[model samples]
Target chain A: MTTLYHQPLDTASRCVRLTLSEYGISTHLEVEKLWERRRAFLLLNPAASVPVLKTDDDLVLVGAGPISAYLSESREDRGAPLMPVDLAARAEVRRLMDWALVLMEHDVTGVLTHEKALKRSIPADHGGGAPDTAAMRISRDNLTWHLDYLDHLLSTRDWLAGERISLADLAFAAAVSSLDYLGEIAWAERSACKLWYARVKSRPSFTPLLEERVSGVIPPAHYDDPDF
Target chain B: MTTLYHQPLDTASRCVRLTLSEYGISTHLEVEKLWERRRAFLLLNPAASVPVLKTDDDLVLVGAGPISAYLSESREDRGAPLMPVDLAARAEVRRLMDWALVLMEHDVTGVLTHEKALKRSIPADHGGGAPDTAAMRISRDNLTWHLDYLDHLLSTRDWLAGERISLADLAFAAAVSSLDYLGEIAWAERSACKLWYARVKSRPSFTPLLEERVSGVIPPAHYDDPDF
Candidate 1:
């Protein structure tokens, strides 16, 4: 069996979980705080970030980007083909996946996670003082634009990249879900984004995400709901 | 011929250039000043980031990650295969590529560029102003660790991912080269990293990079010296 080291609320970690689940790959789940930078974990991944997937063959894969690509590419027949086969379409999927990893994660999910989760655990001197409201405001402001963009993309296509679900959808869903957990997603106004999220939420792979709870942080009541 | 929209000093763009050069792909380079977010550039890439590759068939790739993946996967027989065919080896290459793209860029080159190059352009209201000495100090401090890590990796492997030069090496070299151009890389003490970088810098792909000039910033005298 493979082992996936992850943080329940970490956006990238959630993405790997969705990918693994969508592939129907069973793996041991070990929650990693990442910031602690444990000695053994650092040995496993010098970057000390997760999710780290130790394959059954003992290959240690770190970072969501690598793990997702490895899983999807290496196991062609094991799961639904999350990456499209057509070269142009595959490029589109990869493009959207990069968008989620770079832009969405940085501008939205990263800010919310640091503000809502990690801020409570880190010391004030380490630059984790009271949540930086100004930074959070900027992230939230960017969130509106991102959500609107998603709405625009979804207006013409069923999924982020095309008519069918791909890794891009899962990646976007993972990011939005993290912000949604923080009660940051204003769903009523962004109906298209909300509808897309509902579809993603209904998937069995997303079930695990809904059950995750971080201490001292309460998710919005509708965060895990399939029909909001 | 494909078209590569890039910024001369941008780390990610440099990586794509290296990848294209390695593949012997002829691309017309269009320098992009990302902060300006030109309307036409935004249409090509709403994210308005550099290293956007528009293929001959009119498919527009918006980011370095996607562009590199496309170029390698599309033209497998065009040049030296930068990505390995074996699953595990390919995964390893992808893993290190992500490391350079995400961690290295964020911690070192991104900070140094913002401090050294980008700060001179944007207004204070848009989060650009005088160089942040504190941030530069942090980035420089982080650069030491990064160089050490590269040295450590090279001690065991000829290139970052394995014995042969792969996209990982190109990606990392692209990042460090950007910093080098700003006189940010301290070469003498890190003799191993310097030696390894010399190998990358000597490539024909890197020649174009050495010729690049940003209007107000001058690279160190040794910046383009492959034998340095």
Candidate 2:
């Protein structure tokens, strides 16, 4: 009975989806058109953002951060815990999660999504027009800087946070997945990051994201290929 | 043995400082001039952000979110938890924390901080200039909207998230305190929000924040007045 209000290309929604799937918690997924700012959605979340989760009894969780925390709290030894139990380890996981989901989204994925995909979806009157090339160029500059950091991390650790796959990996996978959908990632230059991304995408939970197709935007050829 | 790397007017830094004080955890606070992008700071956190907590054992916790979560987890049986023990309640608290620290920050506090405070501190070449009037105006519009939401929430709940004080209130207080210091808030129009601010600022943990001063910028006349 848990229902998730999400969107195809939204990184937060994708992160929640992966978290849900990882916990083996299947819920009805509803695509919320955030641009419309629907009143019902506004009632649920005044922020008018995506990835709002309503539990079976109607308790609502707004924002990816909250929903992720709730799902992790309720996970209860299911599969590998996305967040480690050791407090310090958990802090590390949370740190990378914040980096990928918040910082990366703000600098890289969110900007690319808005300029490349979202602008194409909305009408010109609503401040949507041709993509802002300057913004995209800046995003790429940031993307390279972030990828360098991610590459550095991957070189030292088995995964983003530590040895086993954690929510940090999933969050980065979600953000990168959306960018991949828009054909934004330059995989060849970043072999280490690419390998790590491949491992993350190979997860069964990432299948839906790989298969997702936004009408006007076609993904890069290697986007859905786990080996690539 | 513990130390906090922070900047006086930084919202995230203020939030963490308040949380640490509330939990009765004292740390030697060090002012990190973020504009300088200190190499030593970068070694600790590549993100080069403030509010990085270095633990007694040399564990560096970056970002306010992780620091808050880590403190809460270690706060077993401490003074009324800043985050509730109940999972659902924790989710609501997280939601509001995200609202205040992230959403409200991106739209309001962060904007004003950059335009007014941060800009004044940095060199003109470092993207600093006379305060962007258009950006300030937009931030004010967003600030009003956020205050309205806070007013509505306060009207129903005893605190921001629920019946008790939590990190959500502290986070909001941090953001608003910075704005108030800049003399940006229109206190008369938003009576409910003002009252809530008054309550939050009245907490003992808020003393350091009120006493904080930057070299050139001056806080409003009523900035430190608890009853005002």
Candidate 3:
């Protein structure tokens, strides 16, 4: 009986949810509106972020990195490890995952989310004013650049890091999926990335993410379509 | 022998150097001026980041996250693991490391480095312009806030994550050390943080980082002093 505190459209939370599914771990989901900064949630994560997990033993874990690493260290009955057994391959998995965590999420998904979703929800006095169009444009260009890089990688590798699905795939897929939900990805422009994403979409783990809905925001028509 | 591509005051590179030293691995150091964006360096890391490790076996590991993970998965002869063998403890270590990487580095060190060092060294055309005073002020406040959090953690725990010295310590100490080199940390204001840092600074693995010299920028007089 693990409970995961998350927000539906939060990219990090989505990544954790996907990792949990891949590991075949069932968790009770609780939505946390981080902006509200609830006292109990703040105690769970002083950083005031989402995706805090409480294990069956009641050990609390905060942040996507901790949750991802914990889930990857599998026991015999849980599932096969999401991390590669080989050392070098494992490094690649971590490298790709880090890239997604720092570069993709921070630069791209964060930009899009702030502009597309968060701006409309929170009040202006709390630093949530009108969407910064200039920032969004730059992020869009950056997102395209990242898509080119992903396409280059997908041309050679079946998964983001290597031949098999790992946390890297989960991370990259989660990042792109968040922007896709906002209708920001130019899928037709990058055939390799589209093909790779289509494969990710078919996975049962990703199904939960597609079904998620924020309070007042509706996803684009192609948001949940694997064939799109 | 391994080769590490790094910049002298780069926090991520310093973290990797500390990790490698902790594991007793020797490597040739190559200072990469990231702003220069060398073609070969870009080949090694498409992300154009430093602390790219080329192992004796020719496996290239980029970023502190991957490099730390690789170093921690040590064989008996290499060294004892810097990560705790227990699953929950390992998660705690990783949680703190990620907090350092994402919160401390992104918010504080990046701002200070850009303002105090890299801005003067790199050209305006490459996006290195005059330091924004408002941004620097905000970052300074953020740095103080983080130092307070670090002090709060160290008040009860022997190390940042736990009693044992782990990669969490290395990651956080590296971040603060870089900022300390720039004379940004107010040691007098936070006694506990200063005490905890003194312990980290005295470690043999931290020796090389203290001795490093960037080409143009000079660190403060007390930068290398373990007793400071």
Candidate 4:
């Protein structure tokens, strides 16, 4: 059986989980508090990042991009293809996935993880310092620009990215859901984006993700509510 | 004929150039000053990113991942095959590529681009605005960590990542080269990484990339020297 190492509140982890479920692959989910830096988890992924998938062949895949690519090839028939077959369409999907994962989540999720999660999970030997206010401020400023870009993209497409649902939508939704849980989204300013979120939240694969709870961090009331 | 939309000094653009050359593909290079943000260029890429490829079939492939994927599938011979046929090895290669493009570049090249290139290239639109000191500072702090990680990885391997010289090496060298041009690498502190870079710099495909010069920026004297 395939095993997935992840944390409950990690958006990238949730994205992988949703993809796996969509493909009808039953994975042995291992919840890892990565901040603890357990030796076993480090052995699997030296990068010490979440969402590491250990395949039945004993190959450990790190990062969502690789995981999605590998699974897409392995389980083509079970789910809507995460990447298109046509070269141009595939390129668009990959670009949008990068935009969501690298551009938006890099800063926005970094802020939320450090500000909220890291404080509670940092090990004693790791010199648990307070979240850097300067980094948070920069992240906050960057968020507005990114959100506006998403709003523009959502205005024209039913999904956050390409035609029909792709990994890009799952990636963006996972990040946005995490931010929403932290009450970080400027909802009124991103009305179009919010509407798109409604569509993603309505999916069956997203149900398990929405119900996930992280100890000491209760999600906002609207997080699990599909109508929100 | 294949047409590449690029800027001389752009590292990501250079990565694509090296890959194309290695694959023995002759391309018509159209230099686009990404800093200029022309209307035509924006239409091609709303994210205003560089390294977009237009193929003979009129397919516009954006970003290094998609472009590399397209090229790898299009050709059977020429250069070292960057991606592997084995599913496990392929996953590892893709993971390393993502790490280089998303994680490392986000800190290293992004800082140089925003702090130096953007200010110089978009001065009229960014008139009198203070440089993003926080972003620069975080980048400076985070860079050493990445360098250390690379040094550790390259200690027993010839490449920055994986057994073969894959896209991961190209992506990493491109990001590091951009920073090295800005005098950002602490060579003495990362001897292993420097040694690995010395090997990467010697490839024939890397020659044209190293020789490239941007109008306003002067590269380090050692930038084009393979022995350096």
Q: Provide the overall lDDT of each model, using Cα atoms, as 2-decimal numbers.
A: 0.86, 0.89, 0.85, 0.78
- lDDT by residue (tens digit), candidate 1, B1-228: 789998777778889999988888889999877777799889988887888998888889877778888888887666538888777888788888887877888898888888888878777777778898998998889988888889999999888989889999998998989898899877878887888899999989889889888877999999988898
Model 1 residue A108 lDDT score? 81
Clashing residue pairs found in predicted model 3: none
Per-candidate DockQ versus the true complex?
Answer: 0.72, 0.87, 0.82, 0.61
True contacts kept of 2: 0.88
Error of 3 at A169 (Å): 1.1
Docking class of 4: medium
Candidate 4, A123-144: lDDT as tens digits? 6567455767788888888888
- TM-score-superior candidate, 2 or 4: 2
- Give candidate 4 regions above 4 Å deviation: A76-80, A116-148, A154-156, A160-163, A184-195, B7-9, B28-36, B76-80, B112-145, B160-163, B183-195
lDDT of 2 by residue, B37-89 (tens): 88999999999888899999999999888999999988765745888888899
Give the TM-score, chain B only, in order for the candidates: 0.94, 0.96, 0.94, 0.89
**What's the TM for model 3?**
0.96
Question: Model 4: what TM-score?
Answer: 0.83
- Whole-structure CA lDDT of model 2: 0.89
Residues B1-228 of candidate 4 have per-residue lDDT tens digits of 999998665667877888898787899999876667789878878777888988887888888888888788665355338766666777877887777776776666766666765566655664424568788888889888888888878888777556788877887888888888777787778778888898888988888777777656787787778777
The pairs that clash in candidate 4 are none
Cα lDDT tens digits for candidate 3, A38-107? 8988888888887899999988998887788777774534555678777788888888887787788777
Q: Which segments of candidate 3 are over 4 A away from where they belong?
A: A76-79, B76-79
Cα RMSD to native, each candidate? 1.8, 1.3, 1.7, 3.8
